[model samples]
Target: MRNVERFIGDKLQERKDNLSIRSLSTNIPPVDFCSNDYLGFARSGELKHMINSTLASMQNHLNGAGGSRLLSGNTRFTEETEAFIADFHQAESGLIFNSGYDANVGLLSSVPQRGDTIITDELIHASIIDGCRLSHATRFKFYHNNINDLESKLKLAKGNIFVVVESVYSMDGNIAPLLALSDLCERYKANLIVDEAHATGIFGANGRGLINQLNLTKQVFARIVTFGKALGVHGAIVLGSQNLRQYLINFARSFIYTTAAPIHNIVAVNCSYQYLSKIDHQLIHQKITLFRKALKENHIKTLSSESAIQGILFSSNEATKQAAANLQSKGFDVRAILSPTVALGKERLRICVHTYNTDEEIISLVNYLKELN
Candidate 1:
């Protein structure tokens, strides 16, 4: 026990020394720049009302799912919701998971066989990386958003090749070249898996995600969409063919072993999807434009992203942390992405633009960013 304590203490001390220690804080500022509530749905009274109303209408008053989906957890309502989400995303089928992390881990760890090869984007989410770590397949990483590098890796890959990427990368706030990647996968007869975590409820006509927006739903093999991001709810869905759905139901340990999300959470997810069609997503695009324009006017460079997520790179973790602290002090609620999370010198201030942020607020945030130097 003492040895275990010492090991934990040493690891924490290492983090502290590197200024990369992480802690939870409920000290959110009043400003609306740091959260994943891109459409303001997370805080929406309308969404809450919808959820409550839906729950009230449901016959099942059970607080919990009782067991895993494979056991007593499965419900008609849950299966119906999955079908609805799959159809909305133009997928053949959908399987619900507790979270995006679970969906990624379960899908990646279960599908790819020992002789298979998994190639991922260098800047893919940590969840995907962890998923790959659990897989028996050989793994490779291509340069971020570089098709040539990806093609090179694809050529070198053996067995069933799986190419994984995020539609909108979480940290860098950059989008994947899905069309090119899909084409490459087709050329190599490889499978393409897109994690649309940050894209769901932020793109497409009814927030079906980037795959739907780009009309690549038929081209891609699978997609992982989360409700916690722009939908402002909890849970995730893995969209794919009916066969894949069945396979995951039987083989995905994370889904088969874990208790299902409660009835209330599923109701909230259903309500959120219904709310997606009514959302003025254009408002979010306007905010993103306003933010970019403000940044350009202030001559403050940011990562190349038309999405709601934006990043401003800093040379060191200390500088990035200080910038985030400065923004937080000014009540902006912006946060820093430090080393180890990213590469050592690639630390950044990850800013999220939301539909609720006004033009004045965007300009003010940019002005404060300009003052950071």
Candidate 2:
């Protein structure tokens, strides 16, 4: 066999040995607990109707974006949506990207020039880490949520400094100390870039995100807001100054090269925001409270998180996988996170709670998890 084929075979065998060989699963679980659709917008018939009506009014009903935004993909409605997002998020301007990953890759890889330094939380999302790696900037990581360590690194950093962090961590589901981090950035004259992937549509008054909720929009340099999670659609936006938007247009390659998302997708995202504006977010908070209360009552020990993502650590990959399989057998979709995705000792059952999850479902899941523990 060819060397390339043999190398690929070896990697596949390694994954199988580790019990981490992943495959696509299209079957919807009986109990909803593992998806990122925290607000149920992805599953909403009302949102579908809104998208249909908006699309029907369009003069051009083309299925595709036609070309990249730099060429022919840019539309009046898309630009208007960007402006609306900027105004809603209290930013000076907004630029859309194909996905949250693209936004991070584009912004981080382009913004910080050579000789500039990037300081990030050790536990930031993989996209952020990839973006940082793509940049010409020198990068350093501090302990997760450790302000002192960040400051110490900041003192040692040279040239222009950009600090990147996720408002709510994707894996562990813990929130960063944004207020303090923003304060530190201000004191040290560093720009703060926050990826609100998990926080958007779950926090803030109108689901604007954690930055908006904390009133730190003015303090942050750039915010990457994704529609895939709580907003329940596709694509992401970088919110910042108009100059920053213009600069990214000139330099951010990911946004420049990719085919623009379809018109229907942008419409769906806009509709999700409109839907968010009218709904009562208190219902989501109540659900989170109830779920947390159940976990406590069942005496299930998991990572402390006020957000929708919660994780319970198990001793090994085998134990965590068995726990997840047991839950799956009982009609739950709870998934296990194993190394090298997480540290060896951090193998856990990552459970995501959503507004659509019923009270009975939450109780049953917690009781089963308690028994497993």
Candidate 3:
């Protein structure tokens, strides 16, 4: 065999050995407790109407952005949406990115200088890890959500330190100890960056996210909010000071090299946010109430999260997959986050609750898991 083919074969074997071999597949056609569409805005009538109305106006931008944003892609709509996001999040400026992944990679890699230190929670999302690898700064990882551990490292941390964390941890379905972390950052004179991906459009008043709900924007350095999850579209925006925005535009490669996202991603995001802002309170409330009640009734133990994501721990990978398969056969969609996604023995079935999920649907699905898996 060729050397390249042999190398590829060895890599595939490694993934299999670690049980980390992922493959693309289609929907199993059950109640979706797996997607990131928190508000059900992905299929919302109002958002759809907004897009249609915009299209009907025949005021379309070009299909592709055709180049990097700094090159030829920057437009009135891009600037307009950036302003809207910044003002909405109460930040001084906003820089749109291709996706949450790119945003994280770009910001994490670029922001910290050569002598700076980035001490992040051990369980920060993968993009942050990749960004840290690409960055020039020294990196440290404290235990997840352990402020004391962070403080211990803080004692030794040198040169402009930037502490990074997520407001809502994706795999664990739990929040970071943000207030404590914020105060600690302030005390140490360190910058804080909070990824508000999971909390956006759920936690804060008007769904700005956990940081905004706790009013930590002024204290934190940056907030990264994505449109795909709660906002129910594609792309993301990093909210920060005008200085930070200008700096990223000058240095962030992810922003400079990649062709900008299509105008549709921006358009859909704007439409979705507009719908969410004016949405009735009862939309999420009734569903959340039903979901919580069902969990309580079934006694299906889960992590403590009032947000859209939920976790049901199952110790073994086989057990987790069997449970997911059983629920899948029963016409419910669920997936398991195996070891390495979380710590070993902390594997869980990551359940996502949605605003459009009906009371009956939640009840039936929970009961199905109880009876079968």
lDDT scores in order: 0.92, 0.92, 0.86
| Per-residue lDDT of candidate 3, residues 145-209 (tens digit) | 99999999888888889999999999877899999999999999999999999998888888888
Cα deviation at 32, candidate 2, in Å, is 1.0
For model 2, name the residue pairs that clash: none
Q: Can you write out model 1's per-residue Cα lDDT over 130-212, one digit (the tens) per residue?
A: 99999999999999999999999988999999999999999988899999999999999999999999999888888889999
lDDT of 2 at 87: 94
For model 2, the run of ten residues with the poorest summed lDDT:
20-29
Error of 3 at 162 (Å): 0.6
Q: In model 2, what is the error at residue 358, expressed in angstroms?
A: 0.8
User: lDDT: which candidate is best?
Assistant: 1
Cα miss at 115, model 2 (Å)?
A: 0.2
